[model samples]
Target: MLLLATVLLLVEAATAVSPTVRLQYASYEGTALANGVTQWLGLRFAAPPLGNLRFAAPQDPTPEYGVQQADEHGKICLSTAGGPPSNSSDEDCLFLDVYAPSNATRNSKLPVYFFIQGGGFNSNSNPNYNGSGLIMASDYNMIVVNFNYRVGPYGFLASEEVSKGGSINNGLKDQRKASQWVQKYISQFGGDPRHVTMGGASAGAQSVTLHVTAYGGRNDHLFSAVASESQSFPPLRNVSESQFSYNGLAIRAGCASSSDTLACLRNLSATDLQAVNINQPFPGAQQPPLYMYGPTLDYDFISDYTYRAYAQGKFIKVPAIYGDDTNEGTVFAPKNTSSYAESDTFLQNNFPDLTLAQLGKINELYPVEDTPSFPDSSRFWRQVSDVYGEIRYICPGIFVSQQYAKSNIPNWNYRWNVVDPEAAAEGTGVAHTVEVNAIWGPSNVNGNAPASYDPDGVNYPIVPLVQSYWTSFIRSYNPNTYRQRGAPTWEEFSGRNYNRRLMFQTNETEMEGIGRGQQGRCAYLVGIALGLKQ
Candidate 1:
């Protein structure tokens, strides 16, 4: 009788820790954590994009047999730079992870938060995100989902032949496939597809905005709301304009002499192809664009430039939260710049279509000025940073927010200003991606929070505060519904609100308005957005 009792206890513990969910494809057994969160990691949503499928849209995963253990993460997609080393990355990396309350059942129908990882559209950093913290922050009320997508040349390669083969913007298509997978299988995991909120940071944010205007604003009910942090709007070049890049890559890959370059590229070994997949300067440009390959003007999927799409009211009418960091350009700006001529050259290279007169006006608007906040950088560096910030990130976000307001869409805007002491000391105050730890909580940042985030435990409160607002927005669409106590109500960014935005800071969160000078600068840039190809 004693031996039988011990056996029964062990079986019960195994059943509790390994929870299984049956999907149309197969049964997946996920691990249940002590914090009441259950996670199914490295589950394949689409088939491996190999051989002919390279640079093509993702397809549904093949049916699997028996139960698969989803305890480990899948290999990340290959990247040109700043990603996992080549040995750790692969071409067959189209898996996703789902996190939900341990007690959640099929009938629970909880809200879902589908997050996209950002890495400048050239790398996949999905491994950095852990959804368990987000589930715990929601008090086990909602589910969180994140996934991996193809990046670099494997995803964004483009040319006339590639376009003819229907392979443009494969990276964006991978994101769509992930979202569609959620809509199809999330209900089986106790999530409501109707209440899904899509959120992303940086390039992921740009992907959200692009989906908002995808196929000329066709709403497929993929997501009901959006949360975009530090949205980026780089210039959208046409397929013909990208042919040079394709030619260059072909030459480097030893396929230059092939009669059918596209077929040759598709047949090359993944290792050989990856060797030549790297960023290169555009034609006649001194420096390369921050991102080598991005979404192109594929008349079918992308349709038009993002600015024109928003201007013409070609976007889904969804409640959204749009925001950016205080110094968005400091990280992307040219550091060696020291004079107005260098700044002008940088702008000209970035926007080669801009006329000299327009460049002069831009320089006049942002003259060389001392920024005490950045004492280490030269005055010209500050000027170029300011210009790049407005043109690339800040102004684009505000333009989208303004369009939403004009259409009476409920939306909230913000400027993240949380200071990191080390970054401040390095003269990059509140640089890009600093708010990620705050949103995901210190516990989820690879097991421990950086000293900059929880210094002496003084800045710990802001983590919960930031998580509360985000999870609240995920659950109820309105951030104030479940905001932390003493946290001020976040107002909508409407015309009557004077284009006000919440300033997210440590112990000083408040609302502020867009100044007239900044507004004028944005207006000038928006007027010439087409010429700049943005």
Candidate 2:
């Protein structure tokens, strides 16, 4: 059957013409790889959100006159001037890329896997979602979709003046458009839109959960399953509360007096908007100012706070797979704090409405770990990392899974314990995002360098298992059914094992069931989150 499917796909690839249209698109043969992989790169699913359309919801593209060359990648969205992936930062960067088996045919009906790139919605680009590795790793068993969306201020700047119709979470709206695009056009690429699953890590993972909660749980039939690596129900501000950032941004952009702040800001150059640095790479030194641009509770797209929506059982009913790193907080944990008081001050200052009582509870939950690897780690820093991990990431994942498990939601959960040996030497085990290269395969292009680096080769013994489980879920919305490489049987999450998680470690450590160790520590966070919603 596989051989027959291969012949059919090769024949179709040889004679393919684009039948799909967001508005009359045409297909072109993409780069044929040495390993026989093929791609249709830089495909535009929506019209460029430039000028008058800036900050507005995405609109479908205007039909083209002829087949657009999809051999090259699209420009990445505007990012910090020196940040990675590309120097081709522009407002007209809303594009997506598709990858498939060399033999995949339009009639193949292969499962479509839509992946969103994560960078805290501040940095990173579509280039970060290198799908070639996934194809190479999965042997082209599925079609992969990767896309670029507005990031930072260009995507998430919010204010009441702009909130009238400018849309608070335009970045997320762009995400929705990308998913919708797949449902409509993926068939031409040998993809089954009905079998689509969405996946993300870090900010991308947050986006998936947001989709799960968008508009009180409307599925929109975009994705039937979701794989969230490092998913979090991040603390976000309501539209009214976001007025502080909006007021400051408008003033900084010299649009303070404009009756239509959105219009005035839209007319400004992308350079002008990018000039105001709203986010920090870490929590100290030059990291003055609190907060960064993120999704806002507009009472429309994101009607309620995320945790509140989940606790009330108001999210999409799809089965979900989510997990966090064993040392997830180490990467984002605040640095340079000298005393416990500094940590307390920073937390109270950064997070809005954080009460002293909560702060006290947090202090009690985590103490300084002064192990040789974590030598002299401040009580403040450790405590902050603990709270951040719990409230920001850990609890959200477990609590959501448990909620679903109780209702028989069949959500799968895990924790990543395998860190690169290099990071392990520093005591920061498996920091956030180390698993991405294992799954997507890092981009081969490195600015005038050869595609020489291969993380999979270094990660050989374990890479296949992780990649298989992910693709398995994408294909069948279940991982156990496609268990590969003698990988262990991953159990569906249930109330029977409430806080239990599949511990994903190396061969020596072994994948096994590990009790959620922080249930008691996390309860305080869950309570605080619930209280805020009420």
Candidate 3:
């Protein structure tokens, strides 16, 4: 009798430490952290994209036979950055992680935050994001989800044959599949499928925008709200235009001689193929953009340029929050540019189709000036950085918010200018993705929090304030309801005198407006958005 009691007690303790949930495919046992957050890491949401399934849309996961331990994260997807494959990275990477309050049950019906990580569509950087802090900050009122999707040529490869045999935009399709899985299975994890707020940063933010405007504004009822930071609108090349990339990769991979190149490419081992998965020069461009593999216009998944689609109001009418850091382009802009001619050359390299007249007009709009407002290593560097930031990150954010306001959709815009002491000292003031530490508390960030958000650091105070606003929006489409005390009310973007934005700073977060000069600059860019293929 004593032995039986001890065995029962051990089983009970094990069950308590590892909570299990059953879905259609399998039952997963999650780890219970000390902070009262239960996380199920690396739960497969779709089958591995391998063999003939390479470059194809994600398919449902095959059913499992028994309870599987979901303690460790899945391997990251192979990247086009070209490094040796390890146990941590593989082609069979299509898994997601979920974080929820340990005390919550299916009836909790908590709100959900489905976050996507950004890596310029070349690498999977989802490991950097941890949902524990966000869940704790929400006071256990919400669940957070983050996942890995295919990247690089494995995800975005396109060609005429690929269009006929497989689908384009496999990366975007992977995101959609993950969202659908949330809708079908989140309830089992104590989340409300109807209240999901999809969000991302950089390339991930661009993915959010694409999903909003996907299928020419067809709403799949996947998400009810959006939160995009530094949303990007790169040129959307047609599938035919991507044949250059396809042909180059195929030639390098020894598949050019095969009559069935697609099949030949698929038959190559992951390691052998990854050896040659590199970015090549795009057609008509001497140098490729930082991201060579990206969303292409396939007519089925993406019907038009994102800018044009938004102009036609071809986007889901959901409440949203759109924002960008002050110096979004410092990291991506060339530093050696010293003259107008060099800057013009830089522009041509990125947008090779730009006519000489357009280049001249752009130079006039952003003339070289040595002023405190545009401080950088050099005058021309600052000039080109401003131009790059506006065209690539800032203007797209403003344009999207303005379009949302024009359509009477409830949306808020903000500009992040909190000076990180380290970054400021390095002259990359409030550069791209610096706000991520503040958004996810220091405790939850993957590593030691940056000096900016350290306890005694410069930008530490705004952590809770930012967290509350985000959580409030996730819980109830409006950020103002549960905002931190004394935080200013974030006014909705309006089509009035000017589209106002909330400026986030160290201790002073306030509302501001889109100045007339910026408005004019963005107007010109939007006017030629189609010409730019954006």
The backbone clash count of each candidate, in order, is: 0, 0, 0
lDDT tens digits by residue: candidate 3, 1-534: 999999886555343233798899989999888999999999999999998899899999999989999999998898886675688888989999999988777667889999988888888754636788888888889999999988888889999978887779999999999999999999878889999999998889999999999999999999999999889877888889988888988999999999989998899998888888887766777776677888899887898999989999999999999999998877877876778987877776666677889889989998886422334466677677777888888999999998999999999999998888777766667788677778888867676467869778878888888898989999899999889889999999976624899999979999998789988998897777789888
List residue ranges in candidate 3 displaced over 4 A. 1-18, 371-376
Model 3, global lDDT: 0.86
The model with the greater lDDT, 2 or 3, is 3
- The number of the candidate with the highest lDDT is 3
Residue 331 shift from truth in candidate 2, angstroms: 1.6
lDDT against the true structure, each candidate: 0.84, 0.71, 0.86
State the TM-score for model 3: 0.94
TM-score of 2: 0.88
Sort by lDDT, top down from the best: 3, 1, 2
In model 2, the Cα lDDT at residue 497 comes to: 64
Tens-digit lDDT track of model 2 for 171-288: 9999999998888878777788888889887888999988988888877889888999888565677777667666777788788889877788888877777776365422222333
Name the lDDT of candidate 1.
0.84
TM-score of each: 0.93, 0.88, 0.94
Query: Better model by TM-score, 1 or 3?
Result: 3
Output the lDDT of residue 128, model 3.
Answer: 38
Question: CA lDDT of 486 in candidate 3?
Answer: 90
